[model samples]
Target chain A: MENSLITADAVEISEFPHLAQKYSVRGVPKTVINEEYVIEGSGPESMLLSTILEAVEKTGSG
Target chain B: MSFIKDADRPAVKERLRDMRSDVTLSYFTQDVECDFCRETRELLEELSSIEEKIRIEVYDFKTDQEQVRSYRIDKIPATVVSNGGASGIRFYGIPAGYEFSSLLDAILMVSRNESGLSDETRKALQDIKVPVHLQVFTTPT
Candidate 1:
């Protein structure tokens, strides 16, 4: 599944206040992809996959 | 003082029984200023005790320079789940409440050595040549 290419971290904002501030994590389940694209809430698997692909495309092109 | 309640042990054990391979939980923590470090470590220990295939490796965030660098850990109370290989699954805080499911899911996925993604998603992922890091910020609430 090419698992090695994708890294996922579930961060608890309250524990790391600094990270929450840096990422502007004011809500729960805020997903930040590659420090670029930000997903504000949880969604279906398809949505996450698309976000990942979008981030990858942006990184690849830029 | 156990983070995992005794009543929940059997269910947790049953879930972990599906593991096909050994999964290592590499936890990094410092002695000071880390609020959930102790609880996180205890939770991992209790979880590992439930299944023989799951192992917990503790490292100091400030002292374990090599591990910190290799894992690319920049924060305290981080747990990296792997099956003796880089799986790129990590938790950056105490995986409590609903988020605990995510930790278990990662462990099971690593043990199975599969992402459980759909064929189409897997195909799409093939085009990803660069590393994609996903930071899902959540609260225990």
Candidate 2:
């Protein structure tokens, strides 16, 4: 995803408290897309892709 | 202070051998120190030793203001995996445990300078008009 227009970052919650709070992250392995769609746990790759696409559609960018 | 165990080194080295381009791991740290800064640096150093294409460049977060700004790094234990270009790939903490494998995969991908994405994905990404930030939060577990 890094090569696309999508910029991916692996953020460690323990180091960045502000980001965790901003995203309302209460648990581990949270995937946040554009700070809009929040996937609580690690699921199938298709689920992750759909979640991101869903957010993109809602944001009127897709 | 070996982060990579002896048993894992052979396979890791074997995988790293596929590297075709140079990949520099630009690691940022400060004198005051963050929780895992030292460990992060050590891990990067060990990784660099595994392959000729891999290299580590350490910079202080406070002293190396220019490098920090250049890499757009704002936090400690930050690593920018780049190969002559800004790949927009970042690790904001120590790439340990399962994350270590992710780091290796990132290095390989950046070295190849390919996204390894499907044709559909490439077409889909082409449709994007704005920058999408994807942040994956995870622990070592």
Top candidate when judged by lDDT against the true structure? 1
lDDT of 2 by residue, A1-62 (tens): 44446777889887788889999889988989988888998886668767767877877744
Off by over 4 Å in 2: A1-5, A43-47, A53-62
**lDDT per residue, candidate 1, A13-41, as tens digits?**
88888889999888888999999898888
Worst 10 contiguous positions by lDDT, candidate 1 chain B: B30-39
Error of 2 at A19 (Å): 3.4
What are the lDDT scores of the predictions, listed in order? 0.87, 0.83
lDDT of 1 by residue, B1-141 (tens): 987899999988887778999999999998784888899998999998888899999999999999999889988799999887888888998998887888888888889977898888888887679889999898887
Across B25-96, the per-residue lDDT of candidate 2 in tens digits comes to 999998877899999998998888777788898899999999888767877799988898788888999999
Model 1 DockQ vs. reference: 0.78
Task: Evaluate residue A41 in candidate 1 and report its C-alpha lDDT on the 0 to 100 scale.
Answer: 86
